[model samples]
Target: MTEPRASAFITRNVLFALVGGGLGGILFMFFLIEFDHFTSTNQFCTTCHSMTFAETSYQQSVHYNSPSGVRASCGDCHVSEGIIMATYDHAVGIKDLFKQLFGADYNDPVINLLHLPDAAFASRDWFRRRDSATCRRCHLQEAIQGTRVHTAAIHQEETDGKSCVDCHFNLVHRPVPERSTFKREAWNAMVEQEFGLEPGSAEQLLAAGRRPAGERPPAAAAPAHGVGNGQQQAGLEP
Candidate 1:
């Protein structure tokens, strides 16, 4: 009788354990599904504190509203497709959240890139390095048959390792004028530096230090040539 009672008690405990474990697992799965759904939405992304400028630009972009009535949201372009990529993105998002919470001047770089002169090349570089996988997912090459020469040329040029953002950097957003002037100033600085003239005094220095065409300066005179040229092309101040 005692043996039977012990067996009954063990069975009861096992049943309770199974029920509790099953419920916990179900709750966890439900939470994950809800979290994923929430994060996938454009509203969640645009509402984040760091997204003010980006949100404004997105609203003004053709992607927001076009003749075809199609719209692409922030997640459509910024988030990688697939569960693994999404999980990795979320992990990065957590890190960014922590930075926003604790780091001083967390949004300084974003502000500088949007408004300051000679400080936005890093942002441009970031755009340049992105893979066109997401863009291609929506704008498939096979579906892009058109008679427009420029459009066709741009599509064909993708074969040369150029991403869609290369030519269409400002497609969804108007670039800051200061950023454009920064590029020109940076170029002039490179020319000045190559001729051993003062930086930022490009026009005056280049004029006074002008060397004849095909007349290469002494190699020692331009020790920083490579560095200057890289800064010029990248629109970065040296």
Candidate 2:
């Protein structure tokens, strides 16, 4: 009788231990996931001084403010939507943290790119490859209304595989310039020289009409009707 009671007591304790441990593990995992989500917020992204320029530009972007009252944050654009892709992004972010700490100077474009060519290229490539799936998350075709004919045409054309960033690369953050070398007027002049017409000008509209059948303007040259056409068209901003 004594031996049976002892054995029963031991079994009960073992069961309690297993159940308690399982609950504790689950609680810990929940907190960890919540913490990760918190860190992905816009506020957390601007915590680093390296993001100062990006944050400044984002504040003025359509993603930050629009008539519809819907807003997208840093994570919406930068982080992947799927669980697997987001996990991979977090892993890559860890490596980027190390690089930012020791290898690159965020304020010095030349030195930063020189020291982190791979990182720079990787970022550009990621933008080129992502196909604007992140943007589509909110701007789905069914949900979007009042799309301009030109904008609709561009969306249809992208079925050939061009990503959104290919055209809208400067929508949020202009390319960081070399130290003390960025000038808006000079940049505008360079653009006008390359594209044969100033953006949003009458000449640009005429040039668009005259542009050869198969030739596409450089991506930096905003299309006459697509994502870069400023605020006139609806359902184009992301």
Candidate 3:
């Protein structure tokens, strides 16, 4: 009787321990996934400070001012409508994860793409196309109404071409409005001058910072005299 009781007790303890350990592991995994998924840092919409321009504009727009109290993150506007699309976005994020880890290709505003890998050049096109989709998704109602000038451009796209954000991103969520311009001709010419892009069908709508390559613009140039170290870049125009 004594021997049988001891065996039973040992078995019960082992089972309980195994169950507890499994549950703990599962909970930890869940916590990690949530932490990675919902963070402001993880979202591509907030990936670049330049991207946040529209975020600021929306906060001040009629959407936020209305009594209904509607507020949205970048995901709400930029993500596609289906699970398939969401999964695709996550798949693409793996590259970004590596970039963040290595501190490669950071954007301007210290948050935007300050450096770009000229090697995988198609990535920029992918980013722009996706952003354009997000614009159409949220502004579809407004586009239907045709209240804004850009909406006219949206209507012209054959299929997926109508993303209002592609051309008209003016919002900055922060009190400071950073002025960034996408100079189509000058930027391409500059990038070609530096990178020596081969002659081919090039996308003209690509975005570029107003700053000159390898040198900061006068407005963004370092201040002659300041309170702190000269390392600090000038804040964007409000």
- Tens-digit per-residue lDDT, 21-102, candidate 1: 9999899878766776688788887566445545565677788877699898766766667756756667767865774466
lDDT of prediction 3: 0.43
Per-residue CA lDDT of model 3 for 133-176, tens digit only, reads: 65555565434645677666556553375344444432323222
Query: How does candidate 1 score on lDDT?
Result: 0.55
**Which of 2 and 3 is ahead in lDDT?**
2
**Who wins the TM-score comparison?**
2
Model 1 regions more than 4 Å off? 1-30, 104-130, 174-238
Total clashes in model 2, counting residue pairs 3 or more apart in sequence or in different chains: 0
Error of 1 at 173 (Å): 3.4
Candidate 2, position 148, lDDT = 71
Per-residue error for 223 in candidate 2, Å, reads 24
Output the TM-score of candidate 2. Answer: 0.57
List the RMSD of every prediction in angstroms: 13.3, 13.6, 11.8
TM-score of each: 0.54, 0.57, 0.38
Off by over 4 Å in 3: 1-68, 105-113, 116-124, 127-131, 141-143, 146-162, 172-238
Candidate 2 C-alpha error for residue 171, in Å: 1.0
TM-score of model number 1: 0.54
